[model samples]
Target: MNRRAFALTFGLGLAALASPQAAWAEDHLAEAVRHTKAAVDHGKQGQAEVLVTHAESALTHAEAAQKGVYNIHVEQGVSHLKAAIAEGKKSNAQGATEHAAEALTHLEAAKKK
Candidate 1:
């Protein structure tokens, strides 16, 4: 009975992994959006350090999304995200905010496709 149960569990896990059920591109895009929102909020409060953290996360997710399905908008978003990070690290809140917003716009457009 234990052996049977183990086999069943293993088989189910393999099947679940093989299934093309999840939308990976969408998931990555969603993560990017969430982090971008947080970054925007932090930027508004002039928290450049915190904003940079979220912007980095957003950039990671954006790059993941770009990998799943190549899109020009996603590529542009990655570029903007990089700029946001650079500006944030330099303690330039205004520049970071602008770049982060640009990244979001590109990400949103990519999400639609």
Candidate 2:
């Protein structure tokens, strides 16, 4: 095999290896966004307990998305989700709603990237 052919093969192999990880990250990020949106909706409805449930789910997926792919917006989104959960636990509907909204914004930004 020629050097050029070897280089091309190696590059393709690397790409193939990376594709799965990229797809996994995208899937997790999408889930996180979906859950965060739900949390925001529940928060708006003043359902603190329900908001907590969705926020926790969103947090799990957000953290998973961060495992191999680190984005600042996702990081911020995770933080907001945590805050939302905390406030929801305290039955602070307004606070939880605000935090969930913030999380949604950041998660959406991360998805765009």
Best by lDDT: 2
What are the RMSD figures for all models against the true structure? 5.9, 1.8
Q: List per-prediction Cα lDDT, in the order shown.
A: 0.89, 0.93
Question: What is the lDDT for 103 in model 1?
Answer: 90
Model 1 — TM-score against the truth?
A: 0.80
The segments of candidate 1 whose C-alpha lies over 4 angstroms from its true place after superposition are 1-22
Q: Name every residue pair that clashes in candidate 1.
A: none
Q: List the residue pairs that clash in candidate 2.
A: none
Over 4 Å off, model 2: 1-10
TM-score of each: 0.80, 0.89
Candidate 2 lDDT over residue span 2-104, tens digit each: 9999999999999998888878988999999999899988888999999999999999999999885899999999999999999999999899999999999
